[model samples]
Target: MITTNRPTGPVRAVEILLAGARMQVLLVRSHPLIPVVTVVQPVVFFLVVTARHPATADRADLLFAVLLTSLWGGTLWTAGGILRRDMADGTLGRNLVSASDPRLVVIGKCLGSCLLVLALLACTGGTIAVVTGIHVPLAALPWLVAGLVFVALSGTALGYLLSALFVLVRHPVQLTSALVFPVYILGGLLIPTSALPAPLAALARGISLYWAQRLLSSAVSGDGATLPALLVLGALTIAYFLVGNVFFVRVVHRARVKGTIDLG
Candidate 1:
């Protein structure tokens, strides 16, 4: 009998996700600081913000809002970090040259980031709820989880996009933390994009995190425009993934043509 390859689709996707999940887990094990910061950073920031203002009694609740962005921040750096780490360790080029889809591999890595986000969210959310009495509606809990997952997918797409960009540059200053931090601030995670200057707010809407944060806020508060938020989040998630995929493909192709991937 002749050997044959199985068809790839959902099976492949699940496999990639599992692989990505494991990779994310291993990284957390290797570097314990990530989860610690994921759980602690927002609370710390919230404290600093509240100490000065003091009128935002609902600040704890608002601080909880940062979890989604925190998750994406983790995903952003982790996805790129994984790729860059692989490149540094001499595995990225080999994997890129392999027959398996590198996009899927990258997606899988992002899935790993999502797993960490889930854990951190649980710990941080639960702790804050117990300590501050601000809690998500029991009914709306599922929506919040869904919102986080969607945002993670979007962030992963962005991470993959940045990783591709990382290969194009030759120096650390050439990187885009400039845009990353601003996106985190303006993405309506740190503050409502509406609170930002109008022109800057409009620019922030270009990122999926804005919609994701809006959906999460609605889910947690059981108020606001849930339907519109969900619709926009879904659309933005798809757009981010597709755009990232195309960009990664093009960047990798260029790097290969230019013999630059090995330099990563």
Candidate 2:
């Protein structure tokens, strides 16, 4: 008699995620500065701005929001950076040639990024809350954790899309960073939308981070807007993931066609 082993859906997903984790570690370990820089840069800025505006009691709160947004942005940036570096160094092409699904590779790297984001959030959020006295209740824990996880997944999807684009353009850092930073600003992280110019405020309302921030605020404040904000965030995360996956698949195909996908 012969025996065979089978995997369930969740298990398969876990395997894929592990693959992504390994890829992220292997590709990015040499450049630990990315997260280190991310951890420090925002703290310094937050300190400086809060010191100058002592009247803003919410400064630390707003700064925490901004850092949260940057967690997603930084995850995307890290994924794209690793993809670009791998492509340039011929690592991605070689990996693609393996029997493993490119999607698995993508998923694994994203898992790694998600871990980083979670760690950063815990460390940074704890520090700010302690220093600034931003009280988060256990009642808000569910929504807060859910929102962060969704944000991380969305960030991972966005990273895959940007990574594909970076491969195509070969120079996307400035363009991607420019496109991403405003999302944080609009997310009510730095300043409230009411404070932004009319057009910019409108654009901010259109972003997923806007909903995410609202959800987080509601969770923290136990406000009436929590449900609606959660609904919007859920929808946005699904949409972004779908669109990003489609874009990544297309770009991978294009890369294969151009013969730019072979190992160097």
On TM-score, the leading prediction is: 1
- Judged by whole-model lDDT over C-alpha atoms, candidate 2 comes out at 0.69
lDDT tens string, model 1, 30-56? Answer: 566585557677677656656766776
Q: 163, model 1: CA deviation in Å?
A: 1.8
lDDT of 2 by residue, 1-264 (tens): 997686757786688778778768666656665565366755766676677777875553566566666665666567766567676677777666666677667756865765675566568767877888777889989987887776666666666666666666645777776766676666666667899888888886556777777777777778779889878777877776677677667666766776655334
After TM-score superposition, what is the CA distance of residue 134 in candidate 1 from its true location, in Å? 0.6
RMSD (CA, angstroms), candidate 2 = 2.7
lDDT of the candidates, in the order given:
0.69, 0.69
Candidate 2: regions farther than 4 A off? 6-10, 26-30, 57-60, 260-263
Give candidate 2's error at residue 103 in angstroms.
Answer: 1.6
